[model samples]
Target: MSFRSRGPRTVPLKSAEEVDAIVRKIRDDQTRPENYRERSLKLHGWICAKCGREFELSNLHLLTVHHKDGNHNYNPPDGSNWENLCVYCHDDEHSRTILADYLAGKDKKS
Candidate 1:
């Protein structure tokens, strides 16, 4: 039996409005403050600042951006407030802060 040749594949076209919307969405996403994670990683390299743990793309998710001042909205473009922390180290750092607050009576029920 002879094999038949397949025809060229056809793609659906989007309207100009749809294309414009897609471009605007991409631009907004690029400008969002949440991108600080990427900026921090680039500025600090792929190592945990507290534990000195290195990360590769395969395990990058284990690395996280920790804000120095405990403010999620305080991301600065200069990378002054960000540190890359491995999940374990980041948890320990926050736990220490909580423990300090508890010991200092900051979390009193009054």
Candidate 2:
């Protein structure tokens, strides 16, 4: 009827090894340069490849990185696979692909 009478008991804590592993994973992820958006912006300049729109720090959030080959995971360190696009152009780029697939009957493949 003392402290043991509390509603729900506390869950068991993680072991030291488990905690260390989690910390190491977080550190590794933070240090990794997998953010292709930043690299693309640096390599291609702050302009939209298709629409010729430019961006400044105030409107930089509208800039997006696009993969030329349509694969998001195929980022190249040399920036060969990346293009900086404004949000509108990026949406249009993807929309064309969707429209083409629909017209070509490729959408039914799945």
Candidate 3:
């Protein structure tokens, strides 16, 4: 008997409402900024920079863009904020920043 693999199927386009929900989800503070999303995807291969794992768009629940300088207000006018980063890596970057600051403070106290 011959075996047929179902493989994968493409779903129909999302309804307007569904799209809106996704937009709102991405707008959350933890998500990468919209203006920079596409750019980040291109730069980071749509993968988490920290983990080096590839992810589908649907699986990008925690994918985010991070500013190295820690200055959200300095977002350039040209949409440079887009820097694809996987969830774990993005969190690590931010966490590392905080930890460094904390250690520095402790050092001062010492």
Candidate 4:
């Protein structure tokens, strides 16, 4: 007597055209800077994520949306890639990222 064994079915990969379409859709979605900022503000409110500074409607312009992973083209629908930062904190955060990269390069060289 012989027993038959079942194997996992393989899923079909996306065609090149389908992949390109998906990439274009993602790029279009992420390139909407204004929409992401509005959605981030709605998700995180008027408080700065870094410094906890609060903004009122009169000064809401001071609040800016920062891309957490440093990739401006990675905006997700859940606002996971965003943080609301006051202008000062946003500047500082970028400065820190630059400094960290420089230090890492120096360490690698050493």
Identify the leading candidate in terms of TM-score: 1
Model 4, C-alpha of 91: deviation from truth (Å): 0.5
Ten-residue region with minimum lDDT total, candidate 4: 101-110
TM-score of model number 4: 0.63
What is the model-wide C-alpha lDDT for candidate 4?
Answer: 0.93
Best by lDDT: 1
Q: Write the per-residue lDDT of candidate 1 for residues 1-110, one digit (tens) a residue.
A: 99998989888999999999999999998877658998999999999999898999999999999999999999889999999999999999999999999999999998
Q: In model 3, what lDDT does residue 83 have? A: 60
TM-scores of all candidate predictions against the true structure: 0.75, 0.70, 0.52, 0.63
| Residue-wise C-alpha lDDT for candidate 2, range 1-110, written one tens digit per residue | 55655688889999999999999999999999858898999899999999999899999999999899989989879999999999999999999999998999999956
Candidate 1 vs candidate 2: the lDDT winner is 1
> CA lDDT of each candidate?
0.94, 0.93, 0.71, 0.93
lDDT score of residue 9 within candidate 1: 86
Number of clashing pairs per prediction, in order: 0, 0, 2, 0
TM-score of 2: 0.70
Quote the positional error of residue 73 for candidate 1 in Å: 0.9
Instruction: Choose 2 or 4, whichever is better by TM-score.
Output: 2
Worst 10 residues of 1 by lDDT: 29-38
lDDT of 4 at 77: 92
